[model samples]
Target chain A: MPNQHLIEARGVTKVYQTKDGAVESLKPLDFSIREGEFISVVGPSGCGKSTLLKMVAGLLPVTAGTLELAGKPISGPQRDVGIVFQSSVLLAWRTVLDNILLQAEIRRMPKAEALAKARQLMSMAGLAGFEGKYPWQLSGGMQQRASICRALLHNPSVLLMDEPFGALDAMTRETMNLELQRIWSESKKTVLLITHSIPEAIFLSDRVMVMSERPGSIAAIYDIDLLRPRTLDMMGSPAFAVFAKKVRAHFYSQGTLDH
Target chain B: MLRRLLLLPALRPFLLIILLLVLWDLAIRIFKIPAYLIPRPEQVVQQLFAEWPRLLTESWKTTQATLGGFALTILIGIPLAMVIAYSKLVESYVYPLLVFSQSIPKVAIAPLFVVWFGFGIFPKIISAFLLGFFPVVVSTVMGFKSVEPDMIDLARSMGASRLQTFFKFSLPQALPAIFSGLKVSITLAVVGAVVGEFVGSNSGIGYVLQVANGNFDLPLMFAALVVLSTIGVLLFVAIDLIERLMIPWHASQRQVF
Candidate 1:
């Protein structure tokens, strides 16, 4: 059978040695994400969900196991992958448009073409009117959206988002979640989101991977069979509640499993 | 109404200076102070115009030395900061020595600089560099070392090379701190040049001040002092303008509410 996955991780483990002692952040893990799939990795605080994301993004070294992106061994960060974090991380000095154009500039792409694409992405992210404004001048949600636009400006094959909307307020977060779903459907890039929100994971992800505490490993993977074009109404459905309950149960069990 | 409101803030300082001048003139006239003891503002202005050519030449010399030394400081200081910031071993070994050297006042070393480099612009420039170098290096190091970790990670994850990270992120982020250091260094640069001139130079404002003192030319001395103060203010304003032009994103550049 042909491997339809865009990214594959097998027997992955991460060990961190501090001044006090050695700590294993992530246990040996095996997972794979299919092309154009939105997968959210949900786990307790201190779990290695972030560590796993970092390794896949090529921001951290894998102590063991293999990670393949587009059937190529993960060596270092590639321009083909875009990553976003909780913080907007937009360059304060650069205007919104310029910040989005940074990736293109770094890649040495043609300025006119890059800018045209950036303008499209900005409009798609609802940031067209604030193109000249600095990051500090924009509201939190707007800044986060600009950052997302920046990540997508290069047309990366994979989007790795580590709690990108975690810092926003409730209303903004919900709005952003809808915006993100829209963006994802529109872009059709494979996404691996590391989030702590169960409802968010269930609402946005095709598969929610619940992780165990320290020396973290996947406790279980819950598949959401909900139909496409999911909306806030789907979040209130009984089916959504069932899916969320299943993931929450796995998290509860993992807390006991750690003992 | 708008124009008047715009002028109000600046007018306060201008009015304060005028009040100070009026008070000084009145005190001199009422107390019948001798010109040798305290030259009146009018006398100083008259003397300034009379000795304008000499005063202008000396001012030019001092300005040249200050600027030359400041340029040299930037050339040396930024690289030193980069090296120290990039290497922990170098920082640990060199940082203490730098602190110890700075503790030795440049004024005390002025004569030694003159002895070594003679009564040329070199000694004065060296004095200015000594005065200006520490702030530049300290600020540059702080700027380079204090980059946000997330920003670095974001750049790294984009496959940016080490040099690209430094140029794109580190350098820009450090600009505000570097400008702060430059502002302090530029002001001190003038004082350093003047001190070096006072020690041994045959020309420059400090030399003119010494000549006026010997002849008891109080008006001339006050004129030199005014010129010196003006040079310091102009140099500082130049640095501020550059800072505004270069790093307009800095919080310092923002207007208060």
Candidate 2:
């Protein structure tokens, strides 16, 4: 059954050494998400949620345990995994279209094909007219949207998002969430998102994995039984409240650990 | 907009020259200053026109030496910076030597260059190259090393090869810093060429200034000085124009006008 999983992490642990001595960022953790599933991992700041995502993305080396994507061990960054960070990081000098086409250029794809894909993705993200505009010329939300389009331009199997909407305002964040949900449904690419917002995690993800404090381990995993094409009305429902409460309790318990 | 334009920052030297000319004209008329001691702006302008042909030829020679030396500096400086930036050992060995060489007074060594290369363009070109090389190397090193760590990591994670990362990220990002260095060095190239001519030379504005001084032709000397200063300003403006054209995305190049 684990072999069927798109991504599987077994006994994954990460330790970092500082001047004070060894600091365990992540404990032995086991997690998996089925193919084409949207999963969100939520935890407090400094809880190693980012570390876990980095390990999965192969940006950081795993200290122990094996992590695999589609039955292949993740030895290094895989071409099939696309990452979007909190900051748009869109290369200030490059136009939105060029930034989106970066993956294709790096991968040495055919120029004509890459240009076509970049144009399609730009329009898909509602950035058709702004293709020639540099990153600094765009608003924060627009830049982040361009970044998302860039990640998807490569047509990767999985999207690794590390707090992509964390920097946006409340209104823009909600709009982006809906836009992301729509994009995900259309593309059908598996996504692993890291977020501290409980409602956001429940809203965007099919499964929310609550993580504990330093030496972070999965405290719990809550599956959202809500119907497909979930709307904002679902957030006021008792089911959503219950899921949010459960995730909140994990954070409260994490706070109590300091004593 | 026209009113706001008048409030724009003025080059102090240009304003100073205008004031100096006013004082010179007044001192010559009121205090009965002799023509040999201080020449009026009108006399200097006349001298400039009278010697226009010789002045033009000398100006061309100096421009050639200055430009050739600057071109040489860029060809050698950038590659050297890249090597030093990529290797810590190379930086440790090369950087100190570079600093030590720059600390030596270039004016003091101009005569030595003339002695070695003779009274020709070679000495002037060499001097200009020596003056221009260090700033380009220093600025380029800063640019190459100043690439954000996160950006580098992001590129690497995308499976970009080292060469790809350098070309795609490092070099473009370094352009702004490198151009600032170039702006400084372009002005220095003019000064270096003049210094070379001052020590020993048969042509150039510096040579003309020397001949005027020997003959006590103060107006001719002032005329040569004016030409030299104008050349420096013009070269600086040319570099600035190139910077705007090449790296339009740079912050400095984005003029409000």
Candidate 3:
């Protein structure tokens, strides 16, 4: 039997009231994510993918319909959710370890346990011997890793990442993608990652959801039948190419949407 | 490379200032400038050494006024910026008033302060505060407003309360920019204190300069000027050091040695 859905959205929409008029950012979007599943949403720039993630994370209010996380309607920012933004957004005044401990501080977790968890998360993210270093000393990729460690520090079951690797270079992005997959697998937390790269979505996600341009809505959701413990070498394989082509075909047929 | 790196801290600025001082001393002597017209470097330094006790007392008075004004600015300015940052209504009501107040030249108000508060330290402190207050308010407002929207969103997503978000994220993030304001305001505080002293004061570097001016004692005047400038530079550097301590993670603070 299929595992119960950890997150459920029904006809959720976002309308931003501007001076000009009411602007619809997201059309009615419906999707369900199972417990411990890795889901990726790929779309063009300004396609409202980030809006959908925010709505589910309870960071933004939905104009219509409903979004339930862990069987409760998301009204405001809930403690169980963790989000990583497009930029690392690490506080420049905080060191790496302190940055991770910020989540514990917010959640009011036990100090000793949080410190131990932070150390474990740092080692997992390959940030050993770098806890005392400040965010400016780190590369873009390392900063993103620190942010990810921060999000996971509180042991939140749901991870919402909005283009976490979008700011990194090509090589760094690939490495981060792999590292993210490993983290996701090890944590077994439900993840909804929003990205523009098709290969990245197909490479990391169990199910990839494509979004349309303006007044964005889900266009398609493709299941990746690829095996787990996936490596970069898989990206060169025919199976990976086929999955990537399937996602690309929708974008190309419509227009240049991916950015 | 090793030598260059070792000397990188103070070498270039030190050499350049020495060169400028040499040029200034030579130019005064070569021009056959009168003692009243221009004091040579040695004359100014000699005057500084000769009246060390008196000048030191005056310097202390000026320093006290500057510190008082700067502390008041920090007390009042940051909270004002916080109000502006948190509420649109407050910003709309207060921002215009701030701009209007800043437009009134502080020097013009210094004499008025003396008239109202009498010729005491209070007038100097108030004058210094008035002059130094605007930059702190303006920069702090900018700092709070300029926080990346995504960062706020990240805090919200993590279920951070408004207070938590402010204390943990917005306040710390705004620090580097706030320090920039502090750096500018502290030097201005020195000028503000002197301006108040110039209007009406029995003691202070400004008062000494005024006495020397009336007597045509150019060397004493130049000596007071040196002391004034040294106070401004030292205050600015102290602010810089605090910025480094508070926000070493900030990009602006991460300079190569």
By summed lDDT, the worst window of 10 consecutive residues in model 3 chain A runs over A250-259
**Residues A1-259, model 1: lDDT tens digits:** 2338989999999999899898999999999999999999999899998889888988889999999898888888877888888899998789999999999888888999999999999889998889999998999999999989888988998999999989999899999999999999999989999998999999999899989999999898888889988999889999999998888887666357531
Candidate 1 displacement at residue A121 in angstroms: 2.0
lDDT at B133, model 1: 87
The C-alpha TM-scores of every prediction are 0.92, 0.88, 0.92
Residue B181 miss distance in model 1 (angstroms) = 0.9
- In CAPRI terms, where does candidate 1 land? medium
Candidate rank order under TM-score: 3, 1, 2
Candidate 2, after superposition: displacement of residue B7 in Å? 10
Candidate 3 C-alpha error for residue B181, in Å = 1.2
Per-residue CA lDDT of candidate 1, range B68-125, in tens?
A: 9999989999899989988999999999999999999888879999889999899999
Ranking by lDDT: 1, 3, 2
Candidates, ranked, DockQ: 3, 1, 2
User: Per-residue CA lDDT of candidate 3, range A1-259, in tens?
Assistant: 2478989999899999999999999998889999999999998899999888888888789999989988899999878878888888888777899989988887889999999999999999999999998887899999999999998898888999999998899999999999999999999889999999998999999999999888898889999989998999999999999888878877777666642
State which docking tier applies to candidate 3: medium
Window of ten residues with lowest summed lDDT in model 3 chain B? B248-257
Supply the global lDDT for candidate 2: 0.87
